[model samples]
Target chain A: MRRFSWFNATSLTLGFAFLYMPMVILIIYSFNESKLVTVWAGFSTKWYGELLQNEAFLSAAWVTAKVAVASSTIATVLGTMAAYVLVRAGRFRGRTLFSGMIYAPLVMPEVITGLSLLLLFIGIGLDRGVMTIILAHTTFSMCYVSVVVSSRLVSFDRSLEEAALDLGCSPFEAFRLVTLPIIAPAVISGWLLAFTLSLDDLVIASFTSGPSATTLPIKIFSAVRLGVSPEINALSTIMIGIVTVGVITASLISKRASLRLQAEEQAAART
Target chain B: MRRLLLISVPYLWLLALFLVPFFIVLKISLSDTALAIPPYTPTLDLGAGWAGLKGFFAELDLENFWFLTTDDLYWKAYLSSVWIALFSTLLTLIVGYPIAYGMAQAREEWRPTLMMLVILPFWTSFLIRVYSWMGILSQEGVLNQFLMWSGVISDPLMILNTNTAVYIGIVYTYLPFMILPIYAALEKLDISLIEAAEDLGCSRFQAFWLVTVPLSKNGIIAGCFLVFIPALGEFVIPSLLGGSQTLMIGKVLWEEFFNNRDWPVASAVAVILLLILIIPIILFQRNEQKQREAEG
Candidate 1:
């Protein structure tokens, strides 16, 4: 048996505390009744109420949602296609370049990507609005989605796809009926990643957006540039809550799925 | 035809959106700044045929690049960005290594939950995570309050809007990137190797340094590159946490474009920044390729 030392225990406790303490403090301070952010007067939900009533925050939230949904959906399709080509398609012309393009944006500084995309928009006479933001978000986030999906595709069982082909299915039909169902989890996760990336983006959106559009990050950024505010804290807490719930639920579902699969395999072996 | 269509659709989309924009930035970097709507001189006038193309080529010069060399601010910003990225990457590794080792040493059944705990912060909004530090780092913030209350210090430390805050933010935000890779490496480590080393007359500390650290070198390399590359051009962290004294190239580029409206200068700055990043990025790619090959 491997021994767990006191050193290990202490490190783990301190590490997690360091990681979580800032956000924990922020969450606690969100309900402070005092106008001063640091001082504890009493607990109240007034900041949350104020956050809801702010028209600017509401519109920015709506804009962010629209961009996230539109961009992530489009990114998922393109990214999935890119992943399929990368994993399944044998060597083709410009394969190196194709792969490079897919991977470059994954690590490319957001400032450069945002600047280049903005220049492209200007050069092509495209207006900077929600549409431009969508385009920019889809372009970058697709790279992330492809990375997620392609990793899954790399480990996929090929015989399942080959069997569909043997059963007289066209390539498209085989993919749609067999491969899609199998890779649906990866694709969904890819979509979620793309969604969150678009939602969290500030620099790219800031570069691409005009007077006609503003994302939540941009709004929050401008607000916090001065200093911390309770309303912003409330907003941060809400975002943190949603993400925590989403991540926990997804992990639980996947865990249960694997457990059930393990049970089925054991039963099959027993018989 | 079907295969062709599938390849071409994404290929064309990337060509039009990703590849072309990069070329546009490159071209603009060579051109002079203009007061026009597009904000750069000598834009390609394809309608005028050969003469227009010739004229465009003739008009383009390396002035923007030259300007970058003459200006000390750009040079300082680039140098400072590298310094900050390197320093923060080291800090992240220090903070992350122990956590990764601890997680790897954890009970098998508890490992997955621990992994999820580390990843949960990653799934949350990065901006919010960074912004959360503001309330704590501010003069009247919780850290100061705690310190004063405990008689640890009589005065609040000046952390906000300083380079120290920027370092703290970078280390805080990029900690997971460091931890996850190292944990993956340490988890895959064979316990028997350490036991054998002990049997061979090495102490536990000696075994860790000689056997464990060398084995996990790939993870350490990957994690450092992951932190260093993004942190080099990090915008949000420095902009929010750093004061006027902070001089990262990313923030410089943002200011040049937005506050100064010098798109040509911004493009020039970006071009140079990409050049500096190319070496590290290539090395990172090679490392990833090697790891993938080993795994396969």
Candidate 2:
């Protein structure tokens, strides 16, 4: 089974390098004291220091975090509900339409989605601002959350809930006490996915955002469009660092949880 | 009652926000551009009920959609977007297939780490990834500097602000979308199937071609749709990496709506794009439904 063939090794190495090399270069050059993005000078932390003092970038980061938190929270609630219904509610009226709406956002072009949302806001006389952006973000991101949670729900053991019901637990009680806890990890991951989607969105935010609601991606886009600078490199490196740490921590947590679950199962089997 | 409450909340939200907006776009597309807030007219006044509806219907015209057809720029943008999306999807398949296959073939102990490696970059900021390429592909960028320093070329190659850059940016950003699905499909695949194929009269290449490729067809189609659909409407990559002559409909729509302030035309562009995308969208939905059924 251990096929360490030349072809497999080469393809994997090349693919990973192609995937990772740009970020590595960006991170390395972030420390370069040279003003030019490509040039290498003596290493310094001046760009990072400058980045800290930049009011606009900091404000944009704050706005982005606020939107991400709000949108992901709402999307999680709605998406979790949607997922449960899709998986457990059995066939109902408008099931096709419900499922269609759920999946449509996943593949819909950002331009059309953004444009349509913006127009909806305008037609309804809602001012384009943070609220509108949150609404727009929630609309799209909930689909990702639903897909994540629903997949988990699909293979879920329903007999557990049935046993709970047979033992005098109400359906709601059974779900709240038993089912929700089991699916909590998937729900959490769905929230995280939604949060990241909101944070990373530029085009939709660009369309729905007014003057006061500039997101981090929007700010970064405008700045990068002007020209690449050492400050942007510094900022990007910090972002990459944060994301790497977060992902590693998440994977570690899940790994530990799974390990504990395995230990419990083994103990039960032994008993 | 509880089930109904659960069902209606998300359904109503999507209806109001996601489903209803398209009608607004359609209505706006039919209306003439106006120098007023909300931009297009004649406005549908629900308060006026039937008379207003009749007035709005009367004002509605196909002029904007007609304009889209007549304009060479719009058609070029549409055609080129489809063309670029098609080729980039192919490029991603070529590059992604080996990585996905390798991951699927890797030892179980290392699979999680490999999966994490793939998913980690996907969760990072997409705009920053594209921006990173500006550094790599710009004339004075890293690649050029490295090539020049290594004496590979006396002159820096012009890779940035071209169709080539657009392709690279798209293929790079959308690579994860292509790989993850195929990886999932390949991971679910039984190695014994391949072994059995080999035990028969098939060579390794033949085994892969006959057994693995056909098996992964669902994932490949899903991946292609994932890459091709969004790439068709991609705004950021073409705007950032593509040159002035680059004719992506997303960029065109952005310019139309944001710069030119022509809501009717932009809405018309969107409507047409939706019409074009309807087939793929249905296909994607069908694929998903099939996968769900298979899983069940």
Q: Pick the candidate with the highest TM-score.
A: 1
Give the residue spans of candidate 2 off by over 4 A: A265-271, B190-203, B288-296
Query: In model 1, where do residues sit more than 4 Å from their true spots?
Result: A259-271
Q: Candidate 2 on B136-248: residue-level lDDT in tens?
A: 99999989989999999999999999999999999999999999999989988987888899999899999999999999998999999999999999999999999999999
Docking class of 2: medium
Q: In model 2, what lDDT does residue B175 have?
A: 96
Tens digits of lDDT, candidate 1, B114-232: 89889889989999999999999999989999999999999999999899999999999999999999998999999999999999999999999999899888999999999999999
Best prediction by DockQ: 1
Question: How accurate locally is residue B106 in candidate 1, as Cα lDDT from 0 to 100?
Answer: 94
Q: What is the DockQ of each candidate?
A: 0.77, 0.71
Candidate 2 clashes between residue pairs 3 or more apart in a chain or in different chains? none
- Candidate 1, CAPRI quality class derived from DockQ: medium
Q: How displaced is residue B182 in candidate 2, in Å?
A: 2.1
What tens-digit string does per-residue lDDT give for candidate 1 at A158-254? 9988999999999889999988866777898899899999999999999999999999999999999999999999999999999899888877776
